[model samples]
Target chain A: MESSRYANPYQTGFLLGLLLVATIYVTGRGLGASGVFKSVVTTTVEAVAPEHAANQPFYQAVVSKHPGASPLKAWLVFEAIGLVIGAFISGLVSHRLTFKTECPPHVPTKVRWIAALFGGACFGIGAMLARGCTSGAALSGMAVLSVGGITTMIAIFGSAYLVAYPFRRLWIGGKQS
Target chain B: MMGPFVPDIITDQLNLIVGFLTGLGFGFLLEQAGFSSSRKLTGLFYGTDFTVLRVFFTAGITAVFGVIILTSLGLLDRNVIYVNPTFLYPAIVGGAIMGVGFVVGGFCPGTAFCGSAIGKIDAMFFVLGGLLGVFLFAEVFPSISDFYRSGAYGDLTLDQWLHINPGLIALGFTVIAVAAFIITARIEKSVNPDAPVYSFPTKSHAAFAVAAIALGVVVSVIPDRQTRLLERATSVAYQQQHPVERIDPQDLALRILDRDNDIQLIDVRPDAKPGDRLPDALTIAVEDMFGKGWEHELAATKKKIFYADDTKPAIEAATLARILGYRNIAVLDGGLSKFKAEVLEVPAPDHPLSFEEQMVYDFRLASAEKIKKLIAEGGKKVVKKRKIKKVQGGCGL
Candidate 1:
């Protein structure tokens, strides 16, 4: 099916850039996506295992900063909510809002899903290690031309290209040539 | 009065609530653009999907331009915004590590939250991994504490470092974004030649137009608030110049004999009749404060103002002095009624203190000496106490 879900990369990028500006103008801060996830994880970990959360320095930081309230109370969380709603609406309009495994033509569907899970885990750990993910590092970083952000963007894109060949089987799909 | 409304008016708790609400909107927008999928985010690497690159670059440029404009027009203070510092080793190492993580994990922290919100189970696990990652970082924080704090530069903006106007920098960034857009579009087309080209109108285009109008309005209105605040300051400067007049009882008594030292007692009361002048005083009634050309009279003579009714006349005198920009305005310690009480009405002591009041005054003087000693020594109070006693009292205290 022809999906209205996809957008022109340049146009979308420009739109996102505008949104970033709006966020900073009104809020005096840049857009942050990973921080929301960090808050969510911190809050959930704290709730499910308070002792464990307290023992960990990261969770403790979140807890101390938000003594009376949940760590989930953050600008990133609200922005993330908007992101999902907007994406969903876009997907629905494009007829791309469906549950299915998206993978390379050659790869088995289950393997693709497994790869997605593992990939997601690595992204989570890496974002925490770097203090930001793509949105924070590459986008917001380049906005201000922060050296680290530019460096991270280059490293991420460079590394992806360098390693894409090895991981080609997971994406290219079909029986191996 | 102008900026940071939420934190200024409310408690910090509300700040958190505002942060969360703003974040929800951010995440929802990101997810709608298909940022939740690892394949989508990683497309930039393989030349297949460039959505991440496009959206992010656009957003950053838009923000940079908006900030520059707002700051230039004086509608916003750029200093109030946050700018990330550039760290050499850590950022590089950490970024390299995160790059690997991005490919393997697919969802960045933000996208993961967005993914999870829409019932993506993988996102939940991704978030779990992020928690563990942060925990690990914290546990090892002590060893790396020096490294994290090693970068000594405090909050430097790019404009200062680069020695360029921020507006120019923003323009350069916009040029770069536009260039990248062109190149990425070419790459995207070449990579997926068979796919149908998709286009969507940008939401921010409309938002920017609205922003420009709003900023224009704020720029025009700010001067008015500044002018009003300045006017209030100028009026206060005028009152300090005028001093109040004094009525000498000796002069009044001597006025009966027409002595050479008879006081020139000018009356400032407003209710005096045309023929109701005092035996030794000239009348300048209170109601004549503004209407009877006191401005010229006060300006011409350096005589202090005196009145009999109450502090009301003194206040009026001060107010007039302020408006007339007088610098020597002063008030009588007591009005004419008090003068009469002291001179003709009574033979009482000027003051009477109770025993407790005297004791309190003495105590205050002694404490003042102790405070003076403390101040002279730079006020470093070193309390000496036994360590074990403090430990024993800790449980109860």
Candidate 2:
């Protein structure tokens, strides 16, 4: 079955840019995605292994900075929640809501899942290393032209490009997803 | 009064409310922009779709221009805003990892959430993986917290680092984003020739580019915030100057009674109803302090003292005298009421006083004689701290 076409990239991008301006204008901070993940991880760790979370300097920092609030009480967490709701609503309205693995036809579903898991693990470590994920560091950083952000963006894209050739079969196989 | 109503003026429950609302907008926009699709997002890297690049660059450019405009308008203070501090090692290494995640998972943290929301199981895995990643990082943080905290530059903005005008950088960005858009559109066409060609209006592009640059130019041209505020407010403050500096009544009486020819009392209220004032005190209007007519008279006076009623008179008087280069100026410790309580209203010393108390009384009595003499010899005086001679007679012995 043929899937519906997406919006014009440039037009959507322009609108997104305006939204970003509003984000920073009101919040004095740029949009972030991975930070929420970090918070969630910290929360989970705290709940599952309180001693470990308390002992770790990394968890300690996030925990101590906020004295009387859950790690999930973070802005990024709320934003992510809103994001999911928004995407869900949009997907439902656009008929894009489906439970399926989107990958090259020739690339086995298991292989795709494996690749996804590996990628997610790599991203998780890297995002923490950079103190933000793509949304936080790369996009938000570039909003203010931060060196860290620009550098991270280059690293992510550059590394991805460096590895893309090796993983070409996963994407441009006999049939594209 | 203006927005950015979050951390600046509204910092309590309102912050979260605004944040949540902003999130709603962000989520809605991201979904509408089709960012919920990992294939669409990863298409940029694979050369099938350039949506990610277009959206990111557009957002970045728009945000930069918006910030410049807001800061220039004085609605936003660039100083108070939070710009992410650069941590060099973490950013690069972490970004590379996240990039790998993007390719394999086909989602970043934000897009993964969106995708999961849209019932994409792959997106859900990506989110779970992100959690794993963050957890791993935290577990290892004690080992590498130093690395995490490395490259410690505090909230460094690009404008300050590059030493270029923000306006110029903004203009430069507009040129680059437009150029990149055109080039990328071409690349997309060449890579997928069978793909539909969607062109934006050239005039709109030109108008947008022009508008962005125009905003930059306008902000760069305006003077800074402080000079603007001070220039607008100082004259008004001067016009509303009606205040006094109070002197301690006892201190004033002591100084006056000491014939501290060093001190000159001046009654410089806006409207001096001069019936009962300090002995030998001169009466003058507030305007006379700055008047060229009283410049010589003020200059000749050594200690220009006033038992002030409000601070405005002292501030105005001091400002004027400073301009005229008179250094020795003061207001009494307390005003006339304190003076009366300490001196004129004192009951006669009926009880046998201690030796120290008697000496204090003698010193005050002597000062009174000196001040009475000075007041009699015209109101000219020098202001100086009093020196009471040490008592020779024993206390404990």
Candidate 3:
């Protein structure tokens, strides 16, 4: 059966444009996805494994200041939370909120989830080491034309391209249509 | 100096409520746009999906253009908004590492939050890993603290650093965004000529193109090229031109001792109830001071005129000084609070209000709070909050 879910990309893009405008108007900043994720990780590790979190420079930064407040209480965290609710709401409205997993044609659902977890963990570590992620760096950076931002965007896209070849079998079937 | 048109007069609880409300809007948009899926996020790397690229570019262009347009109309002062400081090394290094993280994680921090919010279990682990990374950075800060703090450029903006008008820079970016969009569209078509049609609501593409060109032209024309060095130079010139006429308080004190001249020592804060006046000092409200024209009272008189208020009173006194052209204008450093704390037996509970005094209080409180928070974080936090509170009473204030 044909999937009953589809969105007009142009409308979505326009809506996102409005959302971004609102974000800048209210916060005097851009929307960021990675930074908030790092905050969550720091807050959780600090709670569940205080010693390990304390020992790391990254965890010490956020957790130390907001010792009393929840790590999830960050602006980015709230924004991220909103993102999920928004996306899910859209999904439900469109009847696209499925539990089925996505993977390469030959990969098992379990394997795809495992790879996602591994990749996600690495991304978390990398995002912390760097100050921002794609949304913060590539998108926001390009907006202001910060040389660093542009350079980072280049590095990111370039690196991804270089690495995509090896990862093709995982995402798309290797040597197959 | 970037944002929040409305001040945060409300308490922290209220602030969080606003944050949550805004987050709801942010989260809702991400989900609607299909960022919850890792495959879609990673699609930018692959050839199949360009949704992320299109949405991201469009949003950025809209905001950049909005700021430029608003500033041009005098609705917003660009100077009051905050711009991210460029730390040459840390920013570059941090950004590179993050890029690697993006492909690996298939979800940046913001997307991860959205994914986790929608019950993506792997996104949760990504969040956990990010926290671990932050912890690690903090623990190892001492080893690399020097590098992080070494780039001590205090709040430099592109306009200041580039010695160009921000409007021009904005125009350049707009042109680039449009160019990129066109190129991407062409590439998408060549790769898949029968691409799924998702056109915008414009009546004609030509109208959109003309609008984009008009915006680009307007942004390239802002007048002042605001630069840090130039601002500093202007201030130095101002100070040089108007050397502060210093009047020794001791000289005025000795003049008061004469007691021969009929001098009306006005206590500025007359609304100040009993026990309000500083010991051996007079008090007068600004209205009373100017009521009968202190200008007329002290006109062509040889008698000494003395005015004392809190630390802030000096500003008011300056105005009165200019009006009366008082031979001497003296302001207490500690104000009433300091006087009560340092010298007075019974200190005044109500603090004196002056424009300068308010600024001083604001600057001190904001600085003190920031320093305390920074110390508590032990130097790992990236974003710094600066909230300066000033005492305001008059319509001017």
Candidate 4:
């Protein structure tokens, strides 16, 4: 069987760009993902620790910003749902759907899983601080030439490059690929 | 209909639908570009692949060009579009932290969603970890909240900061993007000699590069719709060609006394004092002619009489209205100054007046008193300024 191939980078990028343009033109806002995580965190807190959530300034700010609605009923939340569906469809068509852990040959699956979790945790905290993840602040912000967005973009990639050497083992094992 | 129809033409509910559809496209494109794979995404850091750079730069530049073109063509309103607010320290610090996250996690939030959907177990764990991180942040929110909002700069753009035309910035970005693409492709080859070489078709790639640059040039050459129209409206030649119809103060006074519902008075003066406004007149700035709310007033069947301190501004406003496709628009001849002198403060003739002239002068004297009383009464009934709706947007909760 022929292996599934990725689409050309430039072609995919152009399509993504057009989609963003359409999004901005129609809704007057850009695409976002981290906001979904924010919604989830806020809603969970409101549900589990209603008293604490009410008392907390952070929760109060969020609640006041979006009054008279469930946090889950946000625009980003709906977009995230659609994102999952779209990715699932793409995976199905490409025959790349498999329940497997991807790690370098020398790296153990347990180690990779731990690393992934730690990384995800770090991303979650960082996105909250940054006001956006890559898609939201960086890409969307760049299209609009937003100063904050561009600043974050530079910091994320620049820092990633600076730190990549130290975290080399996680991807390439003991011997560099 | 202009773009960004949300909350006006496109209801909030429909806007959500638009969001979902766009998100679907976003996910599909990301997955197709191999962003669903951690190794492929992380490869940019390792120098094994530059797919992320290529795709990201291309996409960003494309959208920038698209926005500029749309705005230049008058299909979109730049004013209402949301530009992300800048917080200097938060942006830099948060970005640095996100960078660390990217290196450790192997996927940003967006790619993580796409990655997990493809049944990647590591991605699922990442998602769970992300949730924990956010929860932890919320728990410790009070401590960090101040830092988060420390460097608040509202809706600032790079062009504004640099104090350059947006077109020049766009052009510079295009040049930089194209250069990065070429250089990155070369770096990718040197890093892994045995890796599959992605051939760039010379003709098509060059053509696209040229086209992108051409768009930048086009944007730089053509001013935005508002500026272009304003320039044309104010030009001596254009004004001469498009002479606005004018109504005398006597006619306007008579209409005001009669309370003519068919005529709508529009005060375009920037510094119009209280009680200076004509009765039933709505105040709309000349710049605000392009905004959304005044469409009904401008397009109404009732005649619109634009007035300012002098005839120049009123003529300019009427010409702008005409240019924007409004009809039955006329300037108040000699403006409010003329009206105040002729109608409100009519002077008695020194010489004996002809019978017809005396009768007209007597009519003006009586009408002036009635008009003053009507204006005084109209002042008590406040005319609310039309609010132009601003669309709310950001990544925050």
Candidate 5:
């Protein structure tokens, strides 16, 4: 299959920026991702253990905040669904769709999977604590010049660079390879 | 019409559709920018690739300038726009954790979804792990609730916190972003000499950077609509050139006594003591005249009588209302102080009065007593202030 090249970063970034401005102008909000995962978790908990969900303060808070609808029926959930669809379409167009585990040459697939899982778990908890993920808190927050958003953006990038050395083996192969 | 039409023009169902469309665009952009690849994403940290920085900073700068321009043009209400609230400690700690997650997981939440969509097996695991993380957080939320809620500064903007103009901040960010782009390009070249450089500065790229900085400068120099209009309204030349029609205190008292509905009394005073205001008058400060609440009152056909302790504020507000395209706005002559002396405290005639003067004196004396009684009676009626509607936004849980 002939794979098409990715669009230029600056061009795509400008388009993304315009989209964000339009979203803010029209809906008065920015894009998000992890919130959908939260919704999914909350809904699953509610469905699987109704009594437990009802009894817990966290669950109760979530339920009370979004009264009258199933937790699955949220704006971020719909957006996430759309995001998946869009990505799928992009992948199809680029001939990049393949079921594969991507990792450095030296890293074992099992190790990559474990690291991915651990990272994802950290992101989920971190997003919950920060009130948003990269797209929500950092990118969207920066557009509006929110202090929290910029701070998070700095911390994310800064901390990543700090930890990059220890985690170098996970991404880069040895010089011999 | 001004934007942020949710709950006003756009309904909840339509808003969901908007969210979907925006997300679609967002996902498509991420994929097109090669953000769907974890290797490319992690390259930012390793300095092998700067695609993430290029796109992230460009998009952020674009949106920032876009917002500034829209607000300056009065096309978007900045007040109603959602600014993510700051929780200082939590943001720092959470962001640091997410950073570690970025290195370990290779994809943030948005990119994970994109990768998962394109049939990436590791991204699928990441999603599952994310759900597990959220579940764990929920289970342990009872103990960490206080920490989660701590250090909250509600919807604070960088400009407000820094005590600077928003345009200046936007300009500073633009400069910083451009510098980062240049420096990171050099870093990427040094880190991976054999790798293809996508962000090598071209003629168009340089031109675009210059244009963006120029735009930043323009926005910084040009004041927002409110400030411009307020300045114009307060200027002596503007006030002299565009004089507001003045209504006498006695005439206003007569209108009130007659219970005339054609006249609308507007108190433009920023500070008014309780029970000191005129009957049936709406208190809209000079600054608040541009708000959505006074749209109907200002635009209505009724004669708007603006009053303050002195005439300047009343005249300024009336002038502002006129400039904003409202009609039939008039300032009270000598303001409420004149009204008090002329209508509420009429002195008796000492000498033999002419027929016309006698009639005027009799009317003033009788009207003074009636108006005083009316003020005392009307003081009991509480005027309801209009509530400005805030647009609801945030990452929904």
Candidate 6:
């Protein structure tokens, strides 16, 4: 049996805040995650059609600047790698390392998996447009009191709550599948 | 001075050392908070758990206060700190899209890493989907790049744009955050009483609020770095209007003639030589002055007189020094040649000088001749240049 225990929310948040202070103080930048999505995609494109990857408008602007650097050689990429390792260790220690889909009783496994994929794809693309994802834009921005951070936070949550009502059945539903 | 000794003190490997360590802390804390569980994260949308709101707000305000306090204490220079730049249209449009993704996918990028680590197949698909979306974005970027880069507002903060005290703004945040924490907690309890109600050890929300207000007061008292947060163009404009104070040639000559006990002349010329400098003048290349923190040696100085071979180098180097937060950077008018003619004597030359070294010798030799002429003329004159001035922006988020 997996014993589910987590730190109190406020305490965890307090500690997380200290960590953010240390991060910004030391690195002069905040934690980021979605940049890895762009890195991976660039790596794949570069592998298949190097010319196309280099010639793409986005690629020409960014990837070409760092002449000899590998696509994967990014701070966000490395930090993300460490993050997965850290998370895995936590799950393993807590005895929560099970391969399963987490969903409401009425949501079928197929629907959950599909939703995760489709939703993830949207996040991947949207993160780029905003110049960051939730971690980079919302959380980190709030720490430093950046306007972009504040605005993005409002938009993300406000839009989510706006749509949560119409999609109620997808989450809280009638019967177990 | 106390800490945040990042690129300043430690420059060689900033990201590798600090990035992984900070990331480890971030990942560990997130997992311990149960963000590894998709259901727990999705609970933010449902009223079953408002932990995300509580945690997010608390964390954000804490950092804001922490930075302010550290800065007030002189531990960190806030100017060197990174503020994510603001772009209007994309931030809103992209954020809304991400919100939709959040409701549908149950995890954002950082959480997805943890989710996948916990062996969730759905998390893995989410990662794959993210890759596909980013790839698709890159492919279609030629058309969308305009929209993506549109409405470029430079790095902005409430305090900077509104000209309000950061401390006051921070306290306002405290009021809102405390209210949010209380309200969200109530919403959670009413929505699901069975959800774990946390009782933090020792400290209460009221105490935190008081602490926040106190910190805000402290922040408001510290004098701001004027124009420090402005966009590059604006900052440069401010700098232009407020050029570093200068000491004229005649006034400087009178001071040197008296040999004022406190006057310290520094030569920052790249090719300066032994014969080309005044007595007791320090030799420090412009790069070394800023990069090695040698400029900090003059931190307590009342006046710092620096000189280069030409007015251009002197002006450029001094301007850079000013930008790096040095003070009283007065250039020696017309450098060594002026000093030689104003105060020193000429020596008779036996041979003609042509090589770079020879030219320097000739110039020094010629300076003595000019001094005799100046003595005969009995006056000092100033040099002036025609000015052509102009204007800049950047962002990650």
Using lDDT as the measure, which candidate wins? 5
For residues A1-177, could you state the per-residue lDDT of candidate 6 as single tens digits? 655687777778889899888877666677778888877777778888988876787765557544578757766777788888888777878887888888878888888888888878888888888878888888888777778777888888988888777766667656531
DockQ of 1: 0.27
TM-score of 5: 0.92
Q: Pick out the ten consecutive residues of candidate 1 chain B with the lowest summed lDDT.
A: B388-397
**Candidate 2 accuracy as TM-score:** 0.69
B148 Cα displacement, candidate 3 (Å): 4.9
Interface RMSD of each: 7.2, 11.9, 6.1, 1.1, 1.1, 2.7
Candidate 2 falls in which docking quality class? acceptable
Instruction: Report residue A5 deviation for candidate 1 (angstroms).
Output: 3.6
TM-scores, one per candidate:
0.60, 0.69, 0.64, 0.94, 0.92, 0.74
Best by DockQ: 4
Native contacts conserved, per model: 0.42, 0.64, 0.44, 0.74, 0.75, 0.68
| TM-scores of chain B alone in all candidate structures, in the order given | 0.51, 0.57, 0.53, 0.92, 0.89, 0.62
Q: What is candidate 6's lDDT per residue for B270-330, written digit by digit as tens?
A: 6655545555556666645323235345554756787766554665556666665677777
Model 6 per-residue lDDT at B66: 80
lDDT of 4 by residue, B137-156 (tens): 88888898888898998889
Indicate the residue-level lDDT of B92 in model 2: 74
Interface quality of candidate 5 as DockQ: 0.77
Q: What does DockQ come to for candidate 2? A: 0.37
- Stretches off by above 4 angstroms in model 4 are A1-3, B194-202, B293-296, B349-362, B377-384
Spell out the clash pairs found in candidate 5: none
Model 2, B393: alpha-carbon shift in Å? 71
lDDT of 3 by residue, B13-125 (tens): 55455556666776666666667767777766666566676666666666666766655443444443434444556655665566556666676666766676666766666
In candidate 1 the C-alpha lDDT for residue B77 amounts to 42
- Reference-based lDDT, residue B302, model 6: 54
